[model samples]
Target: MARYVKISSLGPAPCVIEAGGSAEEAVERMIAHWKRMLGFVLPDKPDLIVMPEACDRPSKAHYPKEERLEYYRVRGNRIRDYFASVAAEHGCYIVYPTHMQAEDGSWRNTAQFIDRQGKLMGAYHKNHLVPAEYDANGILYGKDAPIFECDFGRVAAAICFDLNFDELRLQYVRAKPDLIVFPSMYHGALMQNYWAYSCRSHFVGAVAGLPSSVLNPLGETVAQSTNYYPYITATVNMDCAVLHIDENGRQFAAIKRKYGPKVKIHDPGLLGSVLISSEADDLSVRDIIAEYGLEPLDDYFNRSLAHRCAPGHMEP
Candidate 1:
C-alpha cells in the first residue's frame, strides 16, 4: 500500500521570511517534527504528502503581473525548488499550493502535488474565496473545486474555508477520493470551536490537515519557542472501515435525521454564492469501531462537531 502523510501547518508570512528565516524554516519544522514524531512509529517512509495554503509568501515584488510576475515567478519557483530539494533528500512526496494569477486580476490558489522524484504530478486551483476578501461590494469570490489523481490515491484540496461547504466536499466525496486534504488559515476568537467541528464532521477515516496559530493582542507570547506554538497532523485510514447500509438501504439516516432540522443543507451553487452546502457522507461509526477497535476511531469521532461555519442557504 502506498503510504501518505497529511500536513497541518501554520503559514509563514512575508515578515517571517525577512527575519533571517524564510518560509523554508516553517517547512523544515513541519518536516522535521513530522518525521521525528509520526515517522518514528510508521512502518515505512511516506510516499505522498499534503500541505496547507500560502506556502509562498506573496508580495508585490514576487506576485505582481507583467512587471510583477517576475518577482512572483522567482518566489513561486522557490517553493517548488525547495520541495524538490527536500523530496530528494528525504525520499518523500510533497504537495502544496502556490498563488497564481488567472487571465483576469484574480488569484488562483493552485495546489501542486509533487512526487518523491520531484516531478509535478497534479494540480487543483481553489474555487471558493470568502466575501471578507472582497471590496465593499462583495462581488469577488473563488469559483472552482477540482480533484486530482496521484500514484498513491486520488488527491483533492479544500483550502481553509472551503471545508465549511458541505456541497463542495460532497461533490468531491462522490468521486471517492482515497485521501482529501484541507489547508486552512482560519484565525479568530472562536476558531477553536470551528476547527474542531470541521475536522470531526467532514473528515472521517480521512485526514484533515491544519496549521493554526493564535496571535495575542499583546506581544507577550510572540517569541515563544515551538513548545508555545504547535500544530496538529492526524492520519485517518479510509480502507479500514465500511459505510453502514441498513436493510432498507439507509446509510447514515440516524445522524442525518438528528441534525437535519438544525443545520441548513443545500446544493453547491452553480451560479450563486461560493459557499457550498450539503450533508456529510454516510460513514458507519459503529463499523469503524468494530474494525479499528473502539479506542482510536471512537476518540476521534467523540471529539465534537461544533466548528463555526458561515450561514448556509436552504435547498431550493
Candidate 2:
C-alpha cells in the first residue's frame, strides 16, 4: 500500500439560484454544480476533497441583508443533502462547508464532513464568526473545537473567519491533527501558512473566487488551483516526519541508504527542514526516527532552549 493520501481543493465557481426561483430549481442547480466540480477530481482520484464555503449558493453580495439572513434557514437541509449525496458517490472524505440550521433554529457557519462511506462523520461549526455572519445573518457562534479521527489520520476543520482568531489556532496547536480543512470566502494565504507551520499539520484551503491550495507542514504550497480551472489535487504521504535538516542530514541520508525504495525525502532546502515519508506499507518514518534517535525539530528546539545561556560579557 502507498499509505499516501491525496487531497483536492476547489475554489468556488458558483451556481447562483435566482431570487424567487422555485426551491426545486435551486436544489437541481446545487447538485449539478457540486457534481461538476467533483467530477473534475475523479480522474485524479483524491482521497479527500474540499469545497469553499457557501459554494452551494451565490454570495449575498447582491441580496438585501434581511433576505440573506433568512435564506439558509429555509434551504440549508436541502443544500446539505445534495452535497452529502455527491460525497456518497465519490466514496471519499469530503468537507462540504456551508450554512446550517442548528437545533435551536439558529443558523451556523458549519463545515460538514462526510466519511468515505457517505456517513456524516460530524460537523465543525465555525467557532469564530465574522461580524457579518452575526449582524447580517444573525448566526450563532459555536463553542467547541472538534477533531475527528480518520483512517489516514486525525482530521480537523476551521471556517473562513475562524482563521483570524487565535482561539481556534491554539486549539489546533494542542489537538495537533494531521490535516486541517479550511473553507473560506476570504483568501488568507499567509495566515493559512502560519496555522500549518504552527500546528505542524498539512492544510488544504478551499477559497471562494480565488486560488485554493494545499500546504504542507513546512508551509510550502505543494499544489494549488489555477484561474483557468477551479480545482487542484495533490498526493501527500502521511507516514512522514519533520526533522531539523542541519542536525539530521547524516541520519537522513543513512535512512535513505538503508531503506532505499522504502522511503522518500522531500527537502525544499529553504527552511533547514525536510519532509521524509515511508513508501512501504509495513514500515513508516516513525520506525526510522526510532532507529536513528532523531528527535522532532520542535523537541530539539525545546531541548536547545534549556541550554540557552546569556552571551559572555566579552563584548559587553
Candidate 3:
C-alpha cells in the first residue's frame, strides 16, 4: 500500500554573509537570501518544502567564527516568521533549519517545522554536533531524537552532522517515522540511502552545494536535484507494503489484471523488493491484499519465525 505525498528539496548553496554588518543587518541579509530561494520553488504545489540545513544563515564566511552564533540568535525569530508566513501563503509545510537558542539558553543547530496554518509545530535540534559546532562555536548537542506528527505522516529531522552518528539512526529505527527530513550542509552520499533503507522510511536530503535527493525504502534514488536545476520536486507514496518473494509472484499478474491501473506494482529489480500502492482514495493496500489473498512481505517473514530453523544447514 502506498500513501502518496508530494515533497520538494532545495539544494542551493546556503546564504552567504555580507561584509561588515551589524547583527540586525546580517539577519536581514539572511532573511532576504531565504526569500529569494523560496521564490525559486515551483508553484507545482508540493505538500512540504525542505530547505538546506542552516538556511537562515548557512555560512559565516565574512564574519569571525566567534561572532556567528550571536549574530544568528539576534534575529532568529524574524527568520522563523518569514518562513512561517511563506508556508501559510503557499499552504504547505516548511522545514526551516537555522541556529537558535533553546530554553536553556544554549545555541543549537535546529530545524523547525512550520505548519500549513503558519503555526510552529515543533523543532528538532541536531543530536550530533561537529567539533567546530561545540568545541569552537559552543553550540549544544540535542538530547533526544524527536518525531513530529504531520497531516501526511510521521516526520523526523536530522541536521548536517546528525547523519554521521549511529546513535541517532538507531533511535529513529525504533521510533520509525514515515519520512525523514534531512537538511544538511555536508553532502553525505551513500549515507542518505543507508539511513533510508535501514529505517525503512522515505528520505529527503536538502544538501547545500550538492544535489538534493529523495530515497525510498529499498535504498533506491527515486528523485534528485541536478547540476543545472539545483532542486527537485517528487511525489512519494508513503502508504505502501513491501512484498518479498514468495507465493506473491503468482498473484502479481492476476492482481494487476483485476485492478488494472487502480493498483500500482513497483518492482525495483532487486529480486524481491516489490512495492505496492493503490490509486483509489478509499482503497488501501491491506484491502487489496485481503481481497486477492496476497501475502504482505513483512507478514510472510514474521510467519517464518515459527520455525526458527533454516540457517547454515540450508543448501545453496
Candidate 4:
C-alpha cells in the first residue's frame, strides 16, 4: 500500500536574542518566533515537521560561559513544553532540536521526537560533535543511534555535524529506516544526498540560514525551501524501493505496463538506478518487486562482490 506522508521542513534563520535581555524574555521571544514559523505550515497538516538544529538558539549573540549556562538554566524545558503543546494541538509529530542538560550536569545536543498526541516518543542525542561543542560548550558526545517508530514509518535523526561521519551513516544503512531527519546549522553540501542514496531512505534536511530540502532515495531533490519561503511542505510516498537498472530494466517496463500510473519509476539519470514507488492502495513496492523478481540495488552489489571474490574470478 502507498504510505504517503506530508512533511514540512522549516529553515528560518536563527532567532535573535538581545545581548542584555533576560533569559525568560529570550525564551518568550524564541517561542513567539517559532510559533509564527509553524503557523505558516500548520495549515498544510503535515504528518511530520522538522526544525533546524538548535532551533531556539539565539542568532548573532555572544554569551560568556557563565551567561550561557544561566540562560540554559532559565530556558530549561520551556521551549520543549511549547513544542509539545503545538504537536498536541496540531496532532502531528515534531522534531525539536536543542541543547539539553543531563542529570550529571553535562549537556547534549539533542533532537527530541514528539508523537502525534504530543508525547515524547524518543530523542537522538548527536553522536558527532565539533571540538567547540565539547571544549567550549561543555557538551558530551552521544553513543547510540536509535530509530523511532511512528505511525507513518520508521524514522531516524542526524544532527549537523553527524552528517559527515560514516560510522553513524553505516549504522543507519544497516537499520534501513524509511526516513532520515537532519536538523542542522550547516548545509552539509553533497553529503546530504549521499546519505539518502547510501541508506536507501528518504532524507529531509532543515538547515538554519540555508535551503531546507526533501530528497528521495535516489538522492534527487524532490522539494526545497526557496529564498522567498523559509519553509516547504511536501508529500512523499514511503512505500518505495531502490533497484539497480542492470537486471531490472525489463522488470521496470513490465511493472509500468501493468500498473501504469499506479506506480512511479523515477530515474534520476546517470545513477544507473531507479526509485520504484507504489501509488495504488492494493499494492506495495515490496509486492511489486516480488512479482517482478527485481533485484534491490544493495543486493545486486553484494552479489557482484561475492562473484568477484570467487576462486575462478578474474583479477581487477
Best by TM-score: 4
* lDDT (0 to 1) per candidate: 0.43, 0.80, 0.83, 0.92
TM-score, cand. 2 vs. native = 0.91
**Tens-digit per-residue lDDT, 86-198, candidate 4:** 99999999999999999998999999999988899889999999989999888999999999999999999999999999999999999999999999999998999999999
TM-score of every candidate? 0.50, 0.91, 0.90, 0.97
lDDT of 2 by residue, 170-263 (tens): 9998898999999988888699999988888999999988999999888889888888998999998777777887678878778878889898
Ranking by lDDT: 4, 3, 2, 1
Minimal lDDT window, size 10, model 1 = 216-225
Residue-level lDDT for 133 in candidate 3: 88
Better of 1 and 4 by lDDT: 4
Residue 7 of model 3 has an lDDT of 92
Once fitted onto the true fold, the runs of candidate 1 whose alpha carbons sit more than 4 angstroms away are 1-15, 18-44, 58-73, 102-106, 132-144, 187-236, 245-316
Clashes (N, CA, C under 3 Å) per candidate? 14, 0, 6, 0
Distance from true location, Cα of 12 in model 4, Å: 1.2
Q: Write the per-residue lDDT of candidate 3 for residues 1-316, one digit (tens) a residue.
A: 4467889899888577765578888887878877777677747688899988877774666666656756866885888898889889889999988878767777888898999998999999898888888887678878877799999899989998788999999998778798999999897888998898778789999998898999887668999898897888899988776777578878888888888888888888855767787887778888988887888665676777744555754457
Instruction: Output candidate 3 Cα RMSD.
Output: 2.7
Candidate 2: worst-modelled 10 consecutive residues by lDDT = 61-70
